[model samples]
Each structure stands twice: as structure tokens, then as C-alpha cells.
Target: MMDMLLRPRIILDAAEAEDAEALAEIHATGFRRGWSADEIDALIADKTVSSHVLRRESLFGVRRPQGFILIRTVADQAEVLTIVVAPAARGRGYGRRLMEAALRALYRDLVPEIFLEVDEKNASAVSLYRSLGFVEVGRRKGYYAEDHGPGGTALVLRLKLR
Candidate 1:
């Protein structure tokens, strides 16, 4: 049984190449088609990409990642490549915290606008984006493959940071 009284301390930090495996593991917990560690490592190695990880520290001082977010920037614009929180860590405000941190970082770097694509059928994610002030600017048909059916549409959202 899980101990409800001993909550782990959540911490956010910049992601490094060595965190690729942990990021992949968290991604796999949330998505059916998760990116591999090699893919995450290659993306993190890119000069234009910035990533962050959310970690949890247990009472014994053992730390492990619980979520991650990846962003790519070009000139004054930035795009969220991906963000995922482990299944067990969902509903704990980790996603919102990650987005807040990423947006602040982008804003500090002089990025005036940011964008992201989310599956249209993902209500929770869509709601979260809306709460974060992102508006749906476009949609891509059949952009994401569904787990049990045909492909799904992807909603492209944009947020003005400036």
C-alpha cells in the first residue's frame, strides 16, 4: 500500500543528456507511442532545444524524475515538442507546473510567442492548455494515430508570451 502521509517533495530542474532514459520512461507511462531514449537524447543535444524535468524526492532522499517537457525555439518563436507526466503522478499539478516553468524560461529568452500541438481527443490536455491561455490557431487532420481506432486530429495552439 502507498503511504499517503509521506508525500515526496517535487522539484523542477533543467534537463541534461543523461536524463534521456528517465524522460523516456515517464513519456511511455503517458503515451502509447512514446519517444525512445535515443530520440530524446538526440533532441536534447540540439542547440535550439530546451528541456526540463520534474523530480520527486522520497523520505530516504532518493530522487527520481516524474515528468518532463521539451521545447524548441527559432528566432522569436518557440514550440513545445512534448510534455509528459507519469501516470501515477498525474492530477498532481505537475503538468501545469512544467508549463509555467517552460513559459517563464521562453519569455526570459525573448521568445514572444509559443505553440504546441495536442491530440484533439485529449480533453484534459486541451483544458490545461486553455487554462494556460493558449488558443487554438489551427488543426491538422489525422495527425495522431489513435490507440483503438483511426487517426485523430491535432489541435495547434498558440500563446503570446510578450
Candidate 2:
């Protein structure tokens, strides 16, 4: 589905190192700790791995990349490496749109399911996944370390893409 605002113009750019600097800022802003430019470059530059940024109309400041999702296809499945949205864009439904686009882009044919891990304490994010029919499949102990009291666990969730 196309973005309403962009209206037949949503541009999905394969993020490069040059875009990493800006992506790092957004990632750091969304998560407490963001990756460095080199880190983003490493993850995105791998030809086998797919990294993308969703721009409203174009890559320019049309709507400065409100969200991002990274995926790596493994066999008949695709694992979501990371997904984030700018703090200011959190409640605007960008997260949902990003997930939808990511799933369609990466696993439209071979993969029938997609999986990801999410911090258990992130209620909003959990809710969003559940709303998209993601069911809890497992859990990882102490996966997220934060500045808060103690780092929380991560819940593994999966959704059938059929």
C-alpha cells in the first residue's frame, strides 16, 4: 500500500553509508543507544543484507525518514534485525506502515513467516505487533540493557505472512 501523504510516491531507498549518519541519529533518538556511523554502514553495506529507509515522497526532506526496518533472509524465513521509529513519529502509525512495507518487500514469495524480538517492557511496541497479529513465540532473558532500573527481557514474536 502506498503512503497517503506521498500518494503513489513513497520512495524506498537502499540506505548507504552516507545515509547512516542520519539513520544513526534517528536510531539513537528512538532507542536510548544508537549505533555509530560505521556500525550502520557495516549492517547496511552488506550486499546480501537488505537495509532501507522509507521516505514519504522522495529521499529529500519530504518527510525526513520517520521510520526504518532491517531484514535478513535466512532460508525460507526473514528475520527482522531492527525496527524503529523517530520519537516524534511514534504515535503517528509510521511503525505499522514500516512493518507492513518491510514484510512485503523482504518475504513476499519464499518466506511465509517473519520473526523479531522486542523488549518486553515496551508496551506500545508490543501492542503494535500484537495488533498486526504477531504472536509471542519465545523469550530471551535480559536482551535489552537500558539506563532504567534493570535491563528487561525480550519477547520473540512471529507472524505468518500468508
Candidate 3:
């Protein structure tokens, strides 16, 4: 848990071209199959994709990115491609804030519904999504492979924005 007094000021902003490397680095901390900077750059260049980066600014004015959320929209629906927060920054409400900001942006853009897939075993993530009004619509059997054991299922969740 992060100490309240020690937590830095946080800012959430639309991701830009320069954020590709930072986004990739933060993503690598959370997932086994992380995206490369080049791949992130390509995705961000797409018109249908929108991304947000969360940054923390210290009292000394040093700023560093802590997390990011990437979304892709087609027609009236949007999908959360990824959401990652640095391990040290977890449990400090950054993930919830990032998701809130991303959802607001998608709603403003007229997206009627949003969807995402999460590993069924990730209790914290599942609880977070449920708190944000995402309900499970389906599940994929063995959608996520593990190194030491059998694969895990992926729960497909959807949130109605309109």
C-alpha cells in the first residue's frame, strides 16, 4: 500500500507519440507478452485507437509515467486493448482513476458500449471492472496460458455507456 503523504500528484492525459516507449516499459511489468515500443507507436497512430497515460509528479517537480490505458473503437463500440500500472503504484487508486478517465473519454466520443477481456483468476482486476459497471458477457476457455500450470479462462466483460 502507498502512503497517502508519499503519493505524488497524478495527472492523466491523452497519450502522444513520445509516450510509446514509456507505455511499453510500464506494460512489460504487468504482462508476460508485452508490446514493443514500435507496436505501441503503430497502434497509437491508428485513427480508431485512443490511449491515456497516467503520470506522477514529485514535490521536486520530477514527473514520470506510472500507467496507461489503450482503447480501440469501431462504429459504436470500443474495446479496452490494455490497462497496466507499475507494480509499485498498484493499490493506490491509479488503476481506477485511469479506467475512469478512459471511460469518460470514450463516452464523450459517443461510444455506446465498451468491452474488455480479463483473466478470470485476477481477482483485483475482476473486482475493479465490476465496480466500474462491467458485467461478464461471456468467457473463453483457456484463453490465457500459464508457464507452470494449465491455462486460465478469460472473462469477456462489457459496460454500456449510453
Candidate 4:
């Protein structure tokens, strides 16, 4: 196998309340409906998942990802409430890494199963989740508030781990 070398220095930390504005801006730039500053703040400040943020600081500027994986645990099960990558950061593997982190965090919590909802039109995201072993379990009619394109419903996926 070919060896990979070098990686971005991403500092994974819980998002501070102050980071919400930047987060929402980045998300808005990346997705169809960029969350409002207030919305992002609410999501991050929510007690449910204790949301996380990935940051990288340099002399030029600090890179604070607007997207995240919001997960919550219920008994032995974990649910991924949301996952996003900044518009400018897509295709850079941040989404996948964030996903891996979320899964690992849940695993560390001894969660044996995980589930999430995704827009069915988001083929890229669906592929990623499937690659990570999540299978489609159901669908929600008109679940997506805003759409990427083609306007599709939400798909529910689940992964059961040993």
C-alpha cells in the first residue's frame, strides 16, 4: 500500500460560545442555508452533544471549521445529529475526519450502535456514511429544511457495532 505523509494540524476542541459566529458564517458559505449566527450559537451552546470545533491557527489566520458532528448518547446508542464542513473546506477530508472523531468519541463512551439522518440528495455524504458501514434504515418525508439541489427527503442510516 502507498504510504501517506503530512496532515493539517487540526486542534479538536469543544467549541466556545464565542466561536459560533464564525462557525455559522463558514457553514453558510458552504451549504445551501448558512445557519444564522444565532442558530449556530444555539446549536453549539446546546447541552445535548457539547458540540466540538476543529481549529488551526497560523501567523496568517486561524482556521475554525464551521461544520461539526453533533452527537448525543442514549443508553448504549449514539445518534449523530448533524455534520457539516465549511464551503471552502469541502473535498479536503475534514468531513470524513470529523465523522471518524464522532464515531470514536461514541465508541470511547462504549456506544454499540450509531445512527444519523442525511439529505437523500447528498450523494457524497451518503457514500461517506456507507463507506463507514452505516446502512439505510428508513426515510423521512420532506425532512430537509433546505436542500442542496433536486430537492429530496431525508434518509436515516444506522450502524451497529460490536
lDDT value, candidate 2, whole model: 0.77
Regions of model 1 farther than 4 Å from truth = 1-6, 147-150
Q: Write the per-residue lDDT of candidate 2 for residues 15-46, one digit (tens) a residue.
A: 76677887888888866578887888898977
TM-score of each: 0.92, 0.82, 0.92, 0.80
Candidate 3: global Cα-lDDT?
Answer: 0.91
Candidate 3 has which clashing residue pairs, if any?
none
Misplaced by over 4 Å in model 4 are 1-8, 30-32, 60-63, 145-151
**Model 2 TM:** 0.82
Candidate 4, residue 81: Cα displacement in angstroms equals 2.0
Provide the overall lDDT of each model, using Cα atoms, as 2-decimal numbers.
Answer: 0.91, 0.77, 0.91, 0.74
Candidate 1 differs from the real structure by a C-alpha RMSD in angstroms, to one decimal, of 2.9
By summed lDDT, the worst window of 10 consecutive residues in model 4 runs over 1-10
- Scored against the true structure, residue 97 in model 2 reaches a CA lDDT of 80
Model 4, span 1-162: residue lDDT tens: 222223435776777778777777776664667778787778676666656676754445666564676677777877886677776677877788888877777777678999898888788999999999999999987676644653558899999866
Give the higher-lDDT candidate: 1 or 2. Answer: 1
For residues 1-162, what per-residue lDDT tens digits would candidate 3 score against the true structure?
558768788888888888899889999998879999999999989999988888999978877889999999999999999999998899998999999999999889888999999999899999999999999999998788888666889999999999
